[model samples]
Target: MCRGWCWGCGWCCWAWWGRSPPSCRRCSTTGRWIICRPVPIRRGWRRSRSSCPGARRPSWCLCITGTVGSVPPIGRPPPLRSPRSGSGIGWSPSRGGVPAEDGATLMYPVASNGPGTDEKLRDAFVERVREVARSRGGLTVEVGGPGALAADAGKVYESLGGPLLYTTVGVVAVLLILIYRSPVLWLVPLVVAGVADFLSMGVAYGLNQAFGTSVSGQSSAMMTILVFGAGTDYALLLVSRYREELRRVERPYEAMKVALRGCGPAVLASSGTVAAGLLCLLAADLNSSRGMGPLGMVGVLCALLAMLTLLPATLVLLGRRVFWPLVPAYGSEPKARRSLFSAMGSSAGRRPLTVLAGGAVLLGALALGTLDLPGSLKQEDSFVDRPESVAAMRTLAEAFPGQGTQPISVITPAGRTEATIAGIQGHEGVAAVERGRTGDGWTELSVIAKGAPQSAAETATIESLRDRLPESYIGGPSAEQLDLKDTNARDRLVVVPIVLLSVLLILVALLRSLVAPLLLVVAVVAVWAASLGIGGLVFGPVFGFEGTDPGLGLLSFVFLVALGVDYGIFLMHRMREESLAGAEPAAAALTALRTTGGVIASAGLVLAATFAVLLNMGLVQLVELGFVIAVGVLLDTFLVRTYLVTSASVALGRKVWWPGRLSREPAGPVEQPPGETPPSRERVAVG
Candidate 1:
């Protein structure tokens, strides 16, 4: 509506004038020049498009540039800024105060809702800071801080959203095709797994909302991995058994029923063990670990339900066609392939003692790698690939050494606010103190540490402050990390025993023997240790990870112990069935390995591959978790379940089932023809 004489170029409303930096292009939102303050742009200054200042950096604006190719707005209102991209890319005087000149850096900090957590807040704060920088034109504005980094990372994460799911599905689909040797067979399992995934999400969301469960990207990703990984394992065992039962039973429904009866106990036991093990995370003090307990359980239970109900129903409906070219005709026996498991069983059967000893030595050696694992992970080093927050933090570390960027928030009673601040001020490492918002008899204080955030010095300062002011609560990323490490330590003490006890109870109930259950538990525990040892040896050396996730020990122990026991259940259950049906100890052990070995191996592969998908994620925690779990699953599948456990069972004879009826009562005497004498026990043993 009105126009006036602006700075140097033409008529404008604000009368702002300055030399525009050549490196600073016109703002994308309004096509306006940004006057980078203090220093003029050098000919080859590195131009980064992400100079949008948020509360932590210099302030800026987003008006059209008068000197650019596009005409600056003369009378029409400024263009509407896009909340996504148009952050503090431009600067103006009217908004956030004047930007500091070169060598006069300002300490402005914005309270972010966290990167990728709130788009609107991120944009608004970035825009506000850009305006402050724009107010002082020609200066090389320092548009940086933690908020800026988080915003950039958030954008990147948002862009990569849910594509991971598609990638995972595709990976699993190919593996299934190879495993089943039927394109059509993979589809039913994928559909069923997908349904389980969606249902788990809803259940996870409900848990998050109703119970305030913490649902992070990492946990959600792990949940998906579990659903597909464990879900497919269950599906594989069921389908493999179904194909076998079909040869004996005429109808698909009858085959399905008989198949369920045969393998269902093992599958049910496996899922139950995993669910119960994960639920033990409730004992964890860390919010993430505690929340993961329920979320993980939900994913596993959902997968279990899908595999049991949907997969079976679909397979029964599709019947013979699902098998396609490799179809197992009703009344036709499965093709006999000399499988890898059979070969392994042969080796174990030949020299059970030697195989058992060598396997034990190998595992023990690998377990020693645990000593070489990197230290606890730093907050900034938590990601597999550095995100914007990490970059900003790095830049800040170099630019402003010995200064903390994130605030140490202290919540104290309103009446004790002054005393808390005084105590914090007197603390050794504190650099500054700023009083903040107050409400409901509580006062919030932001304390700045002289040392960099999460530094040893900063950690010391935090501990000092917390100790002195017992009533005041101190929290931030640094505090959270420390708490995570400490709480995980405590959780391991409480949860590991619970998990072991729970798994042992489940195994005893399934196999119905003390020694058998103990053998399975000890085998899985050793596998977990050896798996972790492998992680320690390779995480830093091979993958370049500097530190292990704090929860790595407990989480890996729970998963490897639970999932590893899955294959053991299949093998052990088969051995128990054979023992009761009439096979002697050594024969039963070998027979179990021969008959059920292929299916268990297949199940292990599915589970291992599913967890390996986490290696493709962004965070180092997922990568480590994925690597260890995958390795452990494979170990359980091939080495432990196939050789070690089988050898132990064979070597121990009837004592393997100690105190059970199968152990106490030898196989019933065979009734022979009148002319035939019963074969001696010693003769049978030699045979």
Candidate 2:
């Protein structure tokens, strides 16, 4: 049962089903409108008297332009019995009214009734409308309003699931083929990542069903990307190490064990850092953000499990021939060449101060573009390609410039209905008031403001109404948006600090150096700012986006900081290992950069490419998020990790290990291979 407010003739009507007489009567002011119509599957379809048996008929009445009118009950239709003849208000409705020449909108002055029946009703309504339009050639139909918009958004998400999955798989497959250059070897990790994705979906579903965690379309899609992106990264590190070990260890199983032993700590720390950073989102108040925290963490964990356990088992079973074309022969030395990473490291080591300053200045300059970012995105501008619902909203806004099209609902305790009405009657922004459904100890009043929907005046009016009627619940589409904006803002303040602290802690623990962790954290923060600044500059001018998504900043910050620190872990951990093996500080820094640089570069490309898939998504928010993170990952990979971090390590020398025993100790005895003597400290140090 539902009640609705019609803006066309300023009428309040009730829709319901039962047997009742066709007659006109005066309705008591104390009475309420209840049991409204569900959007019909077919137009002009009405229930007959015999359809409902042995049930009491609920009474019905109408308020048209402030005049009392009696309307025929369910199963009967008569021109609205003219309102008690003496009332001056007319029932005339024209083309300029709410019902256009061929179309009309159904306005429900209530919040959504969850996702069950309300969702189906909206879907049925749209299907029926489109069916009619198709049958009657030249007739156009569009479903708009809050209910239809939600239904459309849900539909868009449903459609996106297939394409998003396919595109992500396709992108990862191509990259893996290029990276592995082995027909059989690439298949192993790809299949492993796919299994991890499937596992994440199952686990995420169980979590949602068991714990009542919110699962939105956005979060679900992001989980898939993380599974593949982060999973593949772990796989690459393991595989690269495994291949290196294969050349040294004679047996396949022994080689696999050796590979895992070498890279296992780095993989575990990297995934843990990502999980901890994402989990910080639990501090967020927004349902999507908070929910995404656990869901994303689940994805990373699943990937980590697959890469460590399943991937190693599969590779050991396949043996060395898995890399048939370029199989690593036992005891054969790997090609010794001057790789690009080696050249880059040498440059940074030679001029540490110059490289560090230049990188910092570039990031700071890029961050200045944040000033150009547009305002929070409007609901009408959420989609990358405007749908019919958005078009209809635009038309309504233009047609109804001065009057609010959507009502502001004030649900008060039934006992306090009169007091609420009295307070609302003369409110500053209100233009008209219509009493709506009453039941379950609550009474709903639909107030139409003088200001158009979502305007400054309307927002002020909603805020004022909430202040005036403290006991009543003031809400509607606009109010919901207001709350969303406020909640997102609040979440940023609470979640940002938690994310930073958590990631910093993970880095400090893994690297065992206070200064190194601080440097990594500061560098990633700089990358986030620069990425967002680039988004601000491009989103408006190049992409033609209306405005930025409200949650973009918070989500991007969490991702960039967490994922960016991943490369830092790879480089710093390797550098630490070199230092412990008795290498000089500058040599350790340069060697670490050269050794891990290729893997980090490859992993960064995979992560960035996976997120770039979001650019193809329909929502402006997804596109913006994908763009920022993708750009940040690239910046972190090619610029920050390569130059700034390496240069800082070179310049700081032993102090990069700060207060750790390595900072105070001289180079320990070198572990040289048989018959190969260690180089002198003078030969290894930069300049």
Candidate 3:
């Protein structure tokens, strides 16, 4: 039974199932109103009869919007039968004295009991509204959910920023302070790095804005690291030479010019190789990978410019103030004490083939890990904690019967038979399904799965579903996600080769020797293998980190191969200079190591320390990347540079620069050659 009240109408009514009697007349009386309250019927329902003189049948039409004073007795409250007379019993519904029945509309019947009937009615109401909306103008709805790409990018940036910047800048600052012990010297590299960073970021921003390309946050973090490490390394090389020249030469400006003339090409060549290596990223289809290519290239270029232009200008202005508090004696000669690196270089030069073979075997064994590396795009692997959203997702999974809130969408043509949807429900691993219509006569099905969304098993199931889906129905999200995975995999294969080729080309251009560039490639590849293998062994076995993040592998490959070449360049350039001075192979190697060894080692320390800071990041990807790069630089500087290159130069002898026609004969005794002073016994001659 249902009841309602009409305020100000002062009317109520009830209906009898089978009879009209005298009490019904009360509803029709002039200048009066009637109230007949509802009463529940029992079983097959029977009603009691009452006779009256002015009889009128109870209205078959029951008005639901009226007050029911009581229900009729029959296992229910008795229905109230109010009088039509004036006074307290009956009042005119209208203030002007009209009867309530005179202004009433037709009544409708309402059912009040059933199981699951409410849900059916709600569905019907919603469908009706949707139909009405469709009849007007078609509405469009988003297929999946909101895109979180930007937020994910932001997280990458935040994760990498703190450690890379602070550690690298701090380490370089301390190293510079130690070397010169002067405020100006300590600040020079920092200032130069700042300028390089500004130029790189500005150019990248302009390029992205103009081309409508997006740079990954990871690339930005890498750029920051590159700018500091590369900028400082170049600055140190130039400044060291500048300082040495200042002590020996009378004119500070001429010393600066001499320093530029000697170190400029070497710095440019090193930066060129690094930049070329970064350009390999362009071959990747993944936006993150591609973005890194240009971003890294820009950083190297900026560092190059700062070293060549801004650094020299600043040095010229500072003059001998660069080493003020610790000024050298009137004419300081190069230090004679042998360093550990020089000694190592001497030993390796004496046993070139043995050193090369031993280093090659060790690096080759480490490279084996690369073959066993796994690639997956699980979100857990990307972030530090599973993230709050991912945690909430797990909670939702527990609450539901299936794999939380991850949804796989199935799309089909509208007007599909119900049998088709039933078939989809019967598919393996499908937990539940919801159906809705899309415009243009299409239907969308949201299928819930029983396991983690996007897992290998789930992906397999999705693939099976794609293959098994009825010709009339189609797979949407499941199929598309798989396609994205395949595309990324293909992109990796294509990109890695392209990057390798680009690096080779750059090496040839910088070294101007086909043999040297080829050998350089071999050394870099060895470093890459060794670094990654060590990372795998350490991160997986010792630290309990899971499989390597794919992004880490790609970024690490570029960084290790490209940045690692810096040490090789330093060692080779010095060796070439010493060799051209006509020293014997062993003596030349020792001289090269003794001259450039300290600066290269210092550069390696600064770069490695900077990368090591990434260990503090929460994400395993950063940890892997940080340690891999740090280890690669250390290996390159200490082992490859001091041992391998020195050994090769000795063994190859005059063949090291073969086909270039550089003479092996020593430049005869030091001649004043006009204005220059001949070196005294206190000063060792260097060409």
Candidate 4:
């Protein structure tokens, strides 16, 4: 390395003078030093004038100071040069060139076996990038672009699993403790739910391996939630029924069997409805949505099996002492109490039409909030907290306002490469065109658009390019997102009808009545609408989410409908049982609400809280989905199932069960003994 100060020009020049340049000389005109090695001129090198008549300065005298003969200050370096006209150091200091004084941006096109999908590959790539950057003294690297984004997203998902599981378990445990108010009782359900979750994971993974089903972090997390949420609901119903049966039956084993017999049909119906509804997601066009269908179904079914089998066995083994301090001893009747559910049932029964009309109007009003939801989410805004890749994109947007940093890839036939390039170059939005790799029969062209990435202008440009070059395949991150949005919309149209028909059939079979099934389906649909409306009202304004995820609507609808209907099943199944047990039409409705309302409320709380755990997640999509489902569950439990459905059943009388035996045959005479107070079953106390 050589360093010299040119007094006349007031500039400091640094250069690597290899081999001593054979000879060093001084220019007579300005007394400035020069390397007179007679080296051949390299590309981008220009010859400088020599004061010695016949002597020539070396072409490698690359100056870090200002241009030749300029008198710039010693500290300030020269301006950036174009990428082409410099020796790997002067070009725009950006466009594929690194300045001697600044940094450079390098783009690596990863292959199919790249870091985006593989954790080890991603880690190795990232580590290698850092190693290279570290070897270059004073240089730093920040990996960005589509590959980096995918890698970062993978990292977020990886981090999600442990924390999500722990939080969900803790939340469910606390709620179970509060609801059961028993030290030992909550443990049985919690352990069963945990086992169900793990079993679901194993089954889901097996299905993925066996069937080549795609699994994502989002789907797996949701599957865990379903196992715990739905399984616990089943546990609550069975346990509550077992407690009541213990008072009537002499032994715990007999009581457990009796409890299963009483609540087993409703549990089966609820789980079946959920599983069938989730399976409809298979009809979806989006890979994530379609894959989620089987995964979620497996979770629900695992939970059903665990609750109905393992849970019952565990409780029977534990015996009645499991409900210690408040245990229901055999033949010991519960003290009569006028509970909160009874009060609500009384209100609904008093003015069935008024209550029904008010609930409908309220739900309809909430559904209007859908009009205010934010637009479809952008990839950059998907995370609750911005990651480095998104930050890099923001910087690129600011640094290059008129040119896109990401390329729009176009593949055309090799024979028509020139014509395709010419056609793409003619577009107004195109900033530049570079011919990329050429293979056996195709040529890839990288087109830089004038508009920023993911902006409307860039999207339109991509569309226009696709339209103009029908023979070429156009794709990139933006184009893929465009396709995703379109696919999701299409899936909604196709899958919604299938989910409705499937769930409706299950409900019809469970209720054994067309009218009751229709009422429950409509109620759940209204709940979905209202839940989304509430999301619209709160997502942007309260949570500060910039845009709604494109898949939120479809995902939320499936979950709310599937999960929401479980509560309705519990209520309606109990109501049907009452009607068959010789209760009057109005009495059956009130009795159903009163007997099952506490259990439904507790179950709803557990399910909703389990989902609310998603609010603690790092993705905006999960938060939004969690919020909508949690809110929907609460609304369905307290307002819709407790008040609206009860009132509607009361209003319709036997017609609520139209065409069923209960609707056709007259109610049998009351079977109560002369002194017994109608044998009202003791509802589980949530408080």
What does candidate 2 score in Cα RMSD to the true structure?
Answer: 14.5
Q: In order, what is each prediction's RMSD in angstroms?
A: 15.6, 14.5, 25.8, 19.3
Q: For candidate 2, write residues 1-687 as lDDT tens digits.
A: 011112111111110011011100111111010111222211111122112122111111111111112111112111122223321211111112243222333221222221223333445444443343334233233445565566566666766767888899899888888888878888888887877776676566557557766656787778888999999999889998888777778877777777777789988998899999999998887777888899899989989987887778777777889987879899787766666888999999999999999999999999998999988787778888887767766766654567677777667777888888888888979987766656556776778788977788999999899889877777666777777778788889999999999998888888888999999999999999999999999999999998898899999999999899988998899888788878889988888888888889889999999999999998898899999999999999999999999999999998988878889885586675432223222111010
- Give a tens-digit lDDT track for model 3, residues 1-687: 011122111111111210133321222111011111111111111111111111111111112112222211111112222232211111101111111242321122111111111222322322332233224222221111111211332344544545556766787788777766787677977877866775665566556656644464455667777888888888878887777667667766677777777678888888888888788777776666677788788888878877777677766666665676765444776556646665777678667899988988888888786665555545434555554333433433333323423456555555663655787688777776765434344555556566565566667767666677654433333344455566556666786677678777776666555666666667877888788877766766676664666566677878888887767787677666655555665676677787788788877877787677677666666677888899989988888877777777677776666545443344444443322332212122121
Q: lDDT at 152 for candidate 3?
A: 36
After superposition, candidate 4 runs with Cα above 4 Å error: 1-119, 130-141, 669-687
How far is 64's C-alpha from truth in model 3 (Å)? 41
By TM-score, how accurate is candidate 2?
Answer: 0.81
lDDT of 4 by residue, 1-687 (tens): 011112111111111121022211211011011101111221111111111122111101011212212222122122222233332111011124212222233332222211122233444444443343334333333445665566567667767767888998999999988988899999988887877775665565456546766566788789889989999899999998888878878877777777787789889988988999999998887878887899899889988987887777777777778999788987787877787888999999999999999999999999999999998888878888888667766655554565677777776777888999999999999988877656556666678788977778899999899899987777766767777888889889999999889988888888889999999989999999999999999998899998898999999999998988888998898788788778878888898888888999999999999999999988888899999999999999999999999999999999989888889875665565322223245465443
lDDT, residue 345, candidate 1: 85
How many residue pairs clash per model?
25, 5, 10, 3
What TM-score does each of the candidates earn? 0.78, 0.81, 0.70, 0.82
Q: How far is candidate 4 from the true structure (C-alpha RMSD, Å)?
A: 19.3
Relative to the true structure, how large is the alpha-carbon lDDT of every model?
0.69, 0.72, 0.58, 0.72
Worst 10 residues of 3 by lDDT: 89-98
Alpha-carbon error at 363 in model 4, in Å? 1.7
Once model 1 is optimally superposed onto the true structure by TM-score, how far is the C-alpha of residue 458 displaced, in angstroms?
Answer: 1.4
Stretches of candidate 2 off by over 4 Å are 1-118, 129-140, 667-687
